[model samples]
Target: MFRRKTTEEVPAQTEPRPERPGSKGRPTPTRKEAEAAARERAKLAQDPKAMRKKQREMRVESSRQVRQALKSGDEKYLPARDQGPVRRFIRDFVDSRLGFTELLAPMLLLIIILGTGVLGENMRLFSSTLWIVTIILVILDIGWLRFRVRREVRARFPEESLKGVVWYAVMRAVNMRFLRLPKPQRKIGEALPERYR
Candidate 1:
């Protein structure tokens, strides 16, 4: 029955640990140092000249990459007109043939010169007729190219859209072989492999 009640004393609030000098741990930066770093960061971010220079450098690098991609026939970097296996097949198909479309530019120049009376009046009629014939021939050749490309694309890649592909092929055909991008993987008159058909 003689149980005694013990009283406990509470500890007072402790002070923060003092920072050790010359320790191997990272030293806390002073306020001025932090402000200086912040100012440097802000200067870099806000400088218009620097931003513009960076953008220009990026654009040049991008242009270089795109040009290389086009030269190498890299599908990832190709434009929408040249993308896809179907378009590649169409390019190969058109490139492999000796298309009349290849003469289009020269024929146009001939027509222009002839129509301008570079040839005498007596030959004017001949020039006019020649122009009409050339136009007809170009149309016919384009139609034939479209037809052949369509038939082959249908046989090879039925799911792809024919929208831009025909125009792409026509454009490629009209361009001189040496100037065409992704330069002519096959020689003129080379037959497409049977598998592509």
Candidate 2:
């Protein structure tokens, strides 16, 4: 007897369908559900206290990173003043020399002590002479440093801007070797590397 199969008579397929390669493998969220999720996110974003805390935390983390960069000479996190290849070259140039200005601080302190008459009245004239000599030496050294830095920078970075670079080198030269930010990469009297990019 050729009869049509009844609903109850048909066998159910138990095997799972194979998934397509690009399928998400889950049901898409309904519009209402998606809207609710977006609203929750917006609410969190709009919370003033939470936003302030997050911003403050971010600023602290950024400052900490910059400080670490300054100490370690990590170029990526260095502050704007210390950034760029030209500044780096200037730093290297300055650090390689033993400048007289580095001693200026101690010389000034000695001058101050002598001026205070703590040592003796007789020492005052000697202190004045020492102060005058220190000033002259510092001025000469700085002038030389500026001239040399300008010449080298011009030769090495012909296309780079020289603005503020001479001053930058002078300032770095004035600081004690151990106190310089972005700590010296080259030793005193060490020859600078040919390329600095």
Candidate 3:
């Protein structure tokens, strides 16, 4: 039966509260555990001198690989301009043909020397002749390159952006074949498979 209680009387204590569950995340570590972990981390830390030496070796190896890739025209490691299959094809196509643009560098050198007024009165005629010839040949070569590359690129990659492709091809063509980087993959007059042509 319920007891009648005096002013000082108290109710019996309720059952002790149940323990709260721990969080799903890692629990807080004890002092000994924390100290042991700290010691392990210190032991595993690398020496600064050795770490630097290892990093330098890694960099040197990486650079060597990149150089080899560039020389061999490995698509995976090529610069952005030469990375894509379309660009590779463009390079090959430009390289495999002989075009007037191949004379661009030499012709430019001639123009520069002639324009310096060293030949006196003949300078004007010489400069004008060289300029005219350079312009005509370069234009003709670029036009032909654009037409051929556009056709082949369309055949091979119908969805590729034509934007900048013409310039890319023309620039490659303007340089002598041997001087071009990622040196020509195909021989002169060597054709791509019939589907690409």
The Cα local distance difference test for each model comes to 0.81, 0.91, 0.81
Q: Any idea what lDDT model 1 has?
A: 0.81
**TM-score between candidate 3 and the true structure:** 0.66
lDDT tens digits by residue: candidate 1, 119-167: 7875677778988888888899999998988888887787767777788
RMSD of each: 18.3, 13.3, 20.5
| lDDT tens digits, residue span 21-100, model 3 | 55444568999999997875565465676657767887898878777776788765677777777888888888888889
TM-score of each: 0.70, 0.78, 0.66
For model 2 the local lDDT of residue 136 reads 100
> lDDT at 65 for candidate 2?
97
Query: Candidate 2 vs candidate 3: which has greater lDDT?
Result: 2
Q: Which pairs, if any, clash in model 3?
A: none
lDDT (tens digit, per residue) of candidate 2 on 57-171:
8899999999899888988799899998899999999999998999999999999889888788988888999999999999999999999999999999999989999889989
Off by over 4 Å in 2: 1-44
Ten residues in a row with the worst lDDT in model 1?
16-25
TM-score of 1: 0.70
Model 3 C-alpha lDDT versus the unseen true structure: 0.81
Candidate 1: misplaced stretches above 4 Å? 1-46, 194-197
What lDDT does candidate 2 reach at residue 169?
A: 94
